[model samples]
Target: MRWNNATTGRWTHRLIPNLTPWLQRRHGQVDFYLTQMISGHGCFKEYLHRFKHEPNPYCDHCGTGSIEDAEHALFICPLFVRYRAEAETTTVCNLTADNVMSCTLESQSKWDAIANMAAGILKELRRRERSRRIQS
Candidate 1:
């Protein structure tokens, strides 16, 4: 099957097969982060705080010490535990940055599965954020 389209506006038919070996590096991780728009950092909190909107950097749902960073949203949050479990089922992965990045550099099939899981988590995150906005 095809990969890296519908994920992007245009199809990248020739890029999928060869992208693996490159994704193991820092630059590759950044590329993946940018493409996913979830940097596993405090990007979401910073955006809200930049607008004077979020008030505190602590998570809205988890009440954790850290902000609602992408990692927290995707992996640490109890709210998305079910979704994370679903993602785990795809690879049964331990959910580490190193693991994910290495996986991306290994197999196209695994990478596609990871991409889909990440996209699904982000979709749910967006839904929650939108709902919060509406409620506010």
Candidate 2:
């Protein structure tokens, strides 16, 4: 579902407050990832649904029948287990599934770690999905 301007405003400021400044300092692929997150698209299930890329919004990658949004990719996808663990350690405190959307990282190092992982997650997912398309 496309969010109206008012809703988007609240979501960005409340749930992901540091996103605008973070995007300002990044470019290329990292910028792309942050843009995708902010806009709620890019290889994620709900985005795919809007364009009808796939019939169902459930996450096929994890085989758990969950919606494969950015949150799932960052904090819960088994495919990125190692990266998630690393992201957790790089931050001041352990990162949890909910923290991806709720908590704010107050340090550049922590933000960088998560930002890198976010981009990597998109890269990996795009690669896998591309390969799946090729194979089929």
Candidate 3:
């Protein structure tokens, strides 16, 4: 199944099985910030400001024209589309649907694989952005 936002949380809960231990092992401010960043609710002022911009902060790739939420960053970005194409067979389909019902149901392993691919794509995008900033 596709791991859209709603189902992604549920999938995380199901897969982790032992949230307390995981949290304890990773306990730190960095973990907290990462959680917020992944969930689209980090308290960072600059991050928040990005969503409030006039063009709606939609992804440059997908052109969703809405708040550049976490879902958009991870899934809807057009840049990721190219990344996925290049990495064929390792890419997960980003659910652009409004609800979880639209997500394709897949095995747990498949979902995990896709999630990992998504993470890698996001990391690459960040790396590209950093390189661009350094170049400018």
Candidate 4:
């Protein structure tokens, strides 16, 4: 079942090619940040827009007009560049959406650092989402 689903198709499935290992080795409980990052379901504009909850998919914080998908927000958005830098500095791993699952399984420190980064970014995004709702 695990090998059969390891297709280069869905974003989550691609990142997590082998589900058994990840499920067996994941440290700590899966939190809000991990859930959002892994599942690509959250307050992200791209997700909201896809589900008809948001008017557009563009990131409001970056002003780059890029789709606020999990990959763009976690890996490319300039708004979280500082967070990325700090996480990378601490983990010594170049963070990417594709590698986050593997990196988390590598060590406890890496997991904690990545989790911190994700939590910070998502919390800020959630705040912005609420602000956007109030403004609109």
* Best by the lDDT measure: 4
Rank candidates, TM-score, best first.
Answer: 4, 2, 1, 3
lDDT of each: 0.56, 0.64, 0.43, 0.83
Tens digits of per-residue lDDT, candidate 4, 1-136, equal 4444444348788678787878799575678888888777877899999888889899876765688888888889988899899899988989887787788888888888888988988988899889888999
Find the 10 residues in a row with the least total lDDT in model 4.
1-10
Per-model TM values vs. the true structure: 0.63, 0.71, 0.41, 0.88
Off by over 4 Å in 4: 3-9, 62-65
lDDT for 5 in candidate 1 is 51
For 75-95, candidate 1 gives per-residue lDDT tens digits of 677876776576567765776
- Supply the global lDDT for candidate 3: 0.43
lDDT of 2 by residue, 78-123 (tens): 8788877777787755665436533334666766777777778888
From the highest lDDT down, the ranking of the candidates is 4, 2, 1, 3
**Among all windows of ten consecutive residues in candidate 1, which has the lowest summed lDDT?**
8-17
Q: Which of the predicted structures, 2 or 4, would earn the higher TM-score when compared with the native?
A: 4
The segments of candidate 2 whose C-alpha lies over 4 angstroms from its true place after superposition are 1-14, 17-30, 96-105
Give the TM-score comparing model 2 with the true structure, all chains together: 0.71
Give candidate 3 regions above 4 Å deviation: 1-37, 41-67, 82-94, 97-106
